[model samples]
Target: MTTSNFHGAVGTKAKPVTSQFQFGPWTLTAVKSHILESEGIARQRFEGELELPQVPEMIFADNVLRLQHVAGFGLEFNALDALKLVDAHNDPLKVAVAQAWKEARADCEHINEVVKPFDWTFTTEYKGTLIGKDGVQLKVEPTDERIDLEKLKVREKIHFYEDILLFDDELSDNGSSIMNVKIRVMPTSFFILLRQFMRVDNVVVRVLDTRLYHEAEKDFILREHSYKESKVQDIQGPPHIVTDPNQVAQLLPIKRETFEKLIFPSSSISQKEADAIR
Candidate 1:
């Protein structure tokens, strides 16, 4: 494993710090930057939204976790793209939160004559952004391939590991919204997990997780996404458990799950070629 650290200039003034790790034919990079200033072009990009969290700056475009393969394929997790999954229209969750806010603030001095609706909980189902070496976007196709959890359970030396935060918001004291990614590289394989966890106090708890696993010498990466959610009242556990996404994730049933693969074009060989080489 080879590791390096540096600062990359995103703009004239913003120097995002970056850490990179190289293992086998893959390179993993994480970029982190300070909160976006309220008056910048970056902040303007999020304008026109019905409502943003108090710490909206944390979702600035520059913060990301990226993995690239020598074969010209890459995957990235970024806050900007993840937040796009937040519903702009009036979803059931949004409507419920709005009503709760209205009732909670019924006696407030400045109640608006009309209320705008949005997903107050900031729930999202973004997996990861896939792209090719030429900057063209790629799509993950459904596949039978799956990550071997038993293999991962075996004790192995970790070559590299990193946890990268994309964004986090307190949701105006209603609850919390957070998106983060973690990657671990072993001698024989690498694994990544991108998680988006949202908690709307007394309303709902939601989690969306994306897992990617790639074994050394393999021509493809297996990707899995699982979405789980449950109403706060329906979850049966210690009250404090609700505050921890990791613990609560086990309680919530899986609402949806998907498996896909990202194949490296350069690594693929025809059967005839393989036979000839043999």
Candidate 2:
């Protein structure tokens, strides 16, 4: 994806916000915060970061077998962000940032919520498929609707780590950054697929080229050519599938509910709103 510079949002200052995130077995520190300014107006904003542990060789190997392949935002709101938004008196930029923060938290909640973890068996029934060429998909009825596999932009890549003999989901070195606006917005869009595949905690399943969508019915399908395929030679049999999350963590450190929280951040709802919900 290409990023285009936009006007109207001239950045005046950008400093890292102090924040930290704890995911499963790892701890991440806050990098920085920035105060964005436009039209002679400025508001403090926390630049988002994805902090997770480096994947262990074992986990990396596990992911290679199947295919390769955030936080720090609490105290702010509990202290003043909520009241600040209301106090901003509807200043467009301030209100926008406040709402955006809330939305981000909501994203965290949606991903890590308990609705599914306790009953992951329901994920096996999802029929949706994330269509990233030879990437991965859901083989059964979907447990959650947060991610729409069919909606993902299908991009191609070369298999770098394993041989064509090993048929697992091929990781894309597409070089897309998580902070990429599109990904930041729907942070969980990709993981909902993983969550659907994960049956146990601290683990996520990654499969590619296993379920082929056809004129028939429920089965995961992923087919990617290591190289171009001649019309006459429809080489088959390398389509692989692996059910584990270690590989995924190397790329993005997220375990089931934590992952849910990572994407649908609880910050989406403020202490006031949460109190209201309660």
Candidate 3:
């Protein structure tokens, strides 16, 4: 694991710190910044055109994972991009939450106040932002490739590891919503998991995961996205599990899944140019 650090400026005028590691042909970087301020939140709300979650101030807008290959292919995971996936259309989940809130606060004087509709649960299915080098066209094609769990289970020396929290909220104490990304590098391969977990009290529990895996010296990477969810009442577990997204995620049933492969070019040439040369 090759490690390095750098500093930059962000909101609150605080210096943002970055940590990175270099492996076979890839560079993995994690950037962490202070929580968003009122000014920052207002700007983001306007720019993103979305109603954010409670405690939006906790969001680390600059926190991100940047994984790049020497060939200029890369992927980025960040809070702003993930929050954009929250329901803009009045989905069932949003409606249900609104109704629940109204019913729970029927006696309150402000119960009838008009409120904008958004995915109160803050669920998102974001995988990652794919990046290609200048003049290169990179696309992830559906493939049969899958990550080898058995191999990952084996004990091996870990070269580098990082867990980055992008954003999190308590859903105004109705439940919780959190998004984070974790990565681990080993001698022969690396794995990344970008996850979004949400729980709406007496409503539902959901988890969306995007996994990326690559072996040393490999010319391609494997990517998988899985979504799982279960009704709050239907989820039978210890009392504590309901509050822990990681624990509840194990009990939720899989609702959808997909796999894809990203192939790297042999040289700096674009795929179209390479084909022409061939």
Best by TM-score: 3
Per residue, candidate 3 scores C-alpha lDDT tens digits across 1-278 of 56656555564476667888877557789887777665565555644555443324367877889987666778899887887777754445754565765565455433355355456566788998887668553467999878998988899998888889988877656777889999999987889999888888887888999989988766788999999988888988876787886788889999999999977765644434433543
CA RMSD for every model?
A: 5.3, 22.7, 5.3
| TM-score: model 2 vs. ground truth | 0.16
- Comparing 2 with 3 on TM-score, the higher-scoring candidate is 3
227-265 in candidate 1: lDDT tens per residue? 998988999999989899899999998999999987767
What would you estimate as the lDDT of candidate 1? 0.74
Displacement of the residue 84 alpha carbon in candidate 1, Å: 1.9
lDDT of each: 0.74, 0.21, 0.75
TM-score of model 3 (CA atoms)? 0.82
Query: Which 10-residue window of candidate 3 scores lowest in summed lDDT?
Result: 48-57
Worst 10 residues of 2 by lDDT: 174-183
How should the candidates be ordered by TM-score, best one leading?
A: 3, 1, 2
In model 1, where is the ten-residue run with the lowest total lDDT?
48-57
Collision count of model 1: 0
Q: Which sections of candidate 3 miss by over 4 Å?
A: 6-13, 40-57, 94-116, 266-278
